[model samples]
Target: MTMIVRDFRPADAEAVAAARRSAFPYLVTTAETVTWEVAGAPAERQYRLLVAEVDGQVVGSSEIGVFHESEEPGLAFANTSVRTDTLGRGVGSALVTAAEEWLAGLGAAKIFAWTVEAPHAVTFAERRGYRRGRSSRVQRLDLTTAALPPLDPHGLPDGVELRTAADFLNDPRPLYEADVECTEDEPDDVPAGRLPYDQWITLTWEHPSLDRELTTVAVVDGTVAAYSVAHTDGRGSYWSGMTGTLRAFRGRGLAKLAKNDALHRARAAGCREAFTGNDGDNQPMLAINKWFGYEPAVTEWRYVRELAA
Candidate 1:
């Protein structure tokens, strides 16, 4: 079987989505979401999507782009996913090579990729000059049977109330502000400080996979203090898109309240599986997941490599 890599064409939506699902079962991917992602990419992101084919079948894919939202320039990302059955056929390497050169041309000073915790993944990165870094656990909860702990019933404390993302249909800047605050404090050591409301509107709220109804937000004094944006594929699978509280609202349990509301809505809507990922260093979020009865499903070690100057 001859394996080759190339750019994704419009007609390859179903095949590309299928390949991604086969390679990363933990994700919630749909043809429409994939198409929207490719078409709606911002110019500053330097985004380019690619696919690897073997005997005319797409066996792998890579979403390569700069983290334009990061405070620093030239930091890029190139995540490659290959169907498990098609591994060892050189598809991953080919995709990586193409992605690296493309990103380098965009003036990317450093490139980061995620490799599963398995030995082959480590070997692959090390041999390619990428060094390992902090890891994150991908967790799953069988919602049908998992028992959740008693939520803090302070009823939001004073003038705070909990609502779904749909409530922000008319104005999403509140959610954007909450997101910016929480993201700046997320586990990744790399600095990310972009908070332009217009940019947030374009990149997040307008995302195709976002299930606004399943997303929950905590509003206090007419301000979005925290939120948990949920992602769904119009399927039974659910993913925690982002769960964060504004710095001023951290210890008030707003994050828990928002996520609990999301999970409740998800379960009511027949979602069977729930998934979330957190950096190993983020003990607070890990504890929160534990309270929800989630367990480790998989792990991915972060890797970074510098190109020759």
Candidate 2:
């Protein structure tokens, strides 16, 4: 029963992705995304992807890194997932130990992680000195049979227009600006700061999973008012990475408008299922998701551990 934990290699992408999907099926994971994450991380973040092997077979994986873009310093994260068939073999514990050591060596003051809300999963973290915190729910919509809201582009407000991300291929600064505003206001445990345009371009705008044609934006007076970021695994499944409205556009129902349009586009593009995650306390977004016929698929509990300074 020899178990080993080591840094991820490009050749291990498929196996690592498979382990992740086994733990969280609602997520959009692929070999390309796995490889991109390790290669595209910002140097300041000190990111690393670790894989756990048992008897020469990859059975678990985790990503650990500093929260460089967060307003709060010394914050870091480690998310570990083990293949269900190999869970009791110490694979998870090995990965967690390796990740925590790596982050601590990098001078992180705290580490945040999450697990599906199950008794065994909860106990695993608690035993490792992690305390439970907030929870988020992953919702799923059956795109094949959902009663989606009809989109009437002509019926929009006088200054409003519906457009896709592809419409801004020449210059996406407007979308990036709107995203910065929308993201800052979202409820989260980590206080995320705006990413530089160049980092955003490489890490987000050009992500392998992002589907520009399926992402919808609400334009008001030539400016992006709201938008729905769409990501797909190219396997008939779509994920709403984010759906938000700018401060001035909150009450205008623009977020819903953008999200609905994105969903429609995703379905029309042959996707059969849609998924999204919302913080437990984000009632406004939760309500909107419910309106879209998204039902709770699973709840994930956040956990945190403090390291000695």
Candidate 3:
């Protein structure tokens, strides 16, 4: 049967989400979040979502776009995923070809993609001229089975307080500021460029997957010092979107405090599974996850190819 690759339609949201979930089960994904991404993507991103159909059945999907926020010009990405059952049917190649053509048309000089560390997936990327780059590990915790570290509020600094993201619904600028500062220091192959407050509010703060009530924040002397952003699928699965402490608060264990509080709250809320990812070389963050009893689940490698200008 012939495979057809075309732009994703609104009606394909559910199929696309399902394909992504099958390919990357460690990450949180839903139809609502997929729709929001396509509809609200920044203009500069030039985002395009495409799907590969076989005999009228959607079996693969890809999200391709320039990294608009990157300080470096011409950096782009095309992440593709094929349903596990549909592998070896050419869907993966077709999706990647379509995405590469779309991104190259946008004057992209380099295109990056991620693939699970499985041999077949890595071989597929290698055969496409993509070179391996940095890697990250996905960790999972059985919230229902594992004993979470005890939270000792008394151990917090004298002027420190723990709060939820929902508490700042009326005023999230402080959280935004804290996010910007911590993001700047995150380990990444590509620079983590500055994100404006307005965009943060729209993309991160208002995202459908975010669970404001379960996200914990650490405040020191009335200043936002650290936070753990939580995302839940409302189906017993939870993800730590991000956990970081402001530069001034680093080494004080505030990040641990915030994440511990958030995780405790998540388990209490009946979330059975928890997931998070960290750069392979991010020792501090990896140590923190280890302390929380999260077990390594999967590893993914970033691959990049130069696009002829």
Candidate 4:
């Protein structure tokens, strides 16, 4: 079967989401979330979605764009996912070629991609001049079967209170501030700069997938100290968007407190499974997830390639 790679269309949202889910079962994506992501992307991101077709059927998908939030300029990304059953048909290669050409046209100096830890996946990336970088583990928890630790509001440190993200709807600047502080310390192969408040408000706070009511925030003395952002598909799957505590509040167990509250709320809301990811070196966050009975499900490695100017 001949393979063709082209820009994604609105009608392909479902197929794209399906392909993504097939490639990464731990993710929670729907047609609506995919559509919203493609349409609501900021101009700076220059986000573009591509799909690979065989006999008119979408067998692979890719998300290509510049790392607009990175502190370094000319950093780009092209994450390609081909249905497991459709692998080795040149679909992934075609998609990567198209994505690289498009990003090179945009003057990207370097491009990054992620691939599963399997040998075939790593070989595909290396053959295309992509070098392996950092690795991250995808974790899953059986919310229905896992023995979740109980939440004790009174046991929290004095002056610390757990609140939902919805509590700051009228004024979310504090949450934004906390997010900025925590993200600065996150482990990543590419450095992510501080996210501007305006952009955060539009891309994160107003995003369709973010479940504000389930997101837990730890407030200390009326100040946001740590938070656990939650995203749900309105079904039974819950994903952790971000869970972090301010530098000053790191050792106080506030991050765990916030995530525990968030996960408990998610389970109480009928969520059956929970998913999260962390860099291999992010031991603190990994330990926290382990405490919640999350088991490592899959692993992915970052790959990078330099683009000719």
Candidate 5:
């Protein structure tokens, strides 16, 4: 069957969402998130969310655009996915090829994408001239029966405290600072230094999916030291957005404390499953998450192809 590439329409939201769910079950997704992403993309992003339809059924999608968050220019991405049951019918290739042609036309000089660590995905990327880069390891926690570590008083030094993100309602700048510090130090080939507060407010704070009250923060001597920002589908699925400790406050188990607090709150709020991603090289965070009873779910690899000539 010939796969026909076309731009997704408003009516195709449900099918696109189903395709995404089939492709990436680990994520907390919905038709609304898919629709919101395409409709609300900023002008500079030059984003295009396309779908591949075969026999009048949407079987694949490609979210292609420049990484607007990055400081560099001409660096674009085309992450394509085919529905689990639809992979061998040329749908995936057609969607990817269409996205590539669109991005190349948009003057994208370098394309970066992420594919699951499955052999077929890795092989497909390599054949298309993409070289492997950084990776994100997805971890899953069985929240229902997790025997969580007790919050030890002695584990934290004196003058330290833990709080939820709600405490920062009046002033979230401290949380913002902590985020900037940790994000700067995060292990990534794409280095985003000193993320601005305005962008943080728009991109992180104002995201439609965040569950601020479930998000936890660690404070030491009246200062924000660490935090775990939580995102939920408002149903049951939960995801950890940013979990890190400030540079001045390492070796204190603050990262674990913050994330644990968030996880506890998440379960209390009726979320039975939790998900988080860590860089392949981040042994410290990996150890921390494993302590929380999170096991490996899948590995996703970032791939890059230089269009710079």
Candidate 6:
């Protein structure tokens, strides 16, 4: 059983997405998102999608790219996903090896990855010279059964208005500005700086999975004070990609309001399951998710390895 690792072709999107879902069922993945990631990544990121094939069938895949948006240089990441049924077939190792060689050739100083907190997964990463770091919680909410908060649009705070991402199609600069402010406050190992408007539009706002109708925003005096970005697979699965509020809007419960509205909209739109990730240290957001009846599905730890010069 020879395993061959090679660059990903557009035709491999479905297999790659299936492998990813098999490895981490809690996360939402679709072939369309996989194709968009590979085709729409910024050039400076040096993004490469690697696939592992056994007898012409894809069994694993890895998303490898530089942290081009981070102010810090030489930081890269390579996340490998192998089908659960093929766990011990060395497919993961082969994908990681190929990703490292390519990233090292590009002068990457450090590589980061996320692995499930299970014992076998932890050991696999450790044996590959990766060290454990921060962890995040993957949570799931059953949209069909959860008791979602009532959406009373007219009950918002004084002068605060509720809007959907679709309302900003004419001018999304406000949303981009809000995203920049909110992203800066997110807890992460890498410090990501502001992305150019054009890049944000290409990579985020215009993404195929982004459900503008379900993305709720809180506006205060005509300003985007908070928002919850929604992503859906068109298969009854929804993901809360990001939820944040501007600094000035803190303590107003705007983030909670926005996310609540988004979740409700998702349920009404035929989505059955919802998912979101929260950093272990982010108590506020974690509490918000808990309020929505989301249960802990899994924990994934960030792993890092210094590349040998």
TM-score of each: 0.94, 0.97, 0.97, 0.96, 0.92, 0.97
Q: What does candidate 3's lDDT look like per residue over 1-309, in tens digits?
A: 978999888888889988998999977888898899899888888999999999998888999998889999999999999999999888999899989988888899999998999988999999999999999999999999988879884577789999999999999999999989888887786775888788898889999999999999999999999999999987798999999999898899999999999999999999999999998998999999999999999999999999773
Candidate 6 lDDT over residue span 213-271, tens digit each? 99999999988999999999888989999999999989999998899999989999999
Off by over 4 Å in 4: 153-155
Clashes of each: 0, 0, 0, 0, 0, 0
In model 3, which residue pairs have backbone atoms overlapping below 3 Å? none
Off by over 4 Å in 6: none
**Cα error of candidate 1 at position 304, Å:** 0.7
Query: Tens digits of per-residue lDDT for model 4 on 126-160?
Result: 99999989999999999999888887845888999
**Tens digit of lDDT per residue, candidate 1, span 102-150?**
9888888889898788877789899999988889899999988877654
Tens digits of per-residue lDDT for model 5 on 120-157?
89999999889999999999998888888766756566
Stretches > 4 Å off in candidate 3? 153-155
After TM-score superposition, the amount by which residue 258's alpha carbon in candidate 2 deviates from its true location, in angstroms, is: 0.9
Misplaced by over 4 Å in model 2 are none
Alpha carbon deviation, residue 72, candidate 3 (Å) = 0.8
lDDT of candidate 5 at residue 278, scale 0 to 100: 94
Q: In model 5, which range of ten residues has the least summed lDDT?
A: 187-196
Clashing pairs in 1: none
Error of 2 at 47 (Å): 0.4
Superposition error at 187 for model 5 (Å): 1.7
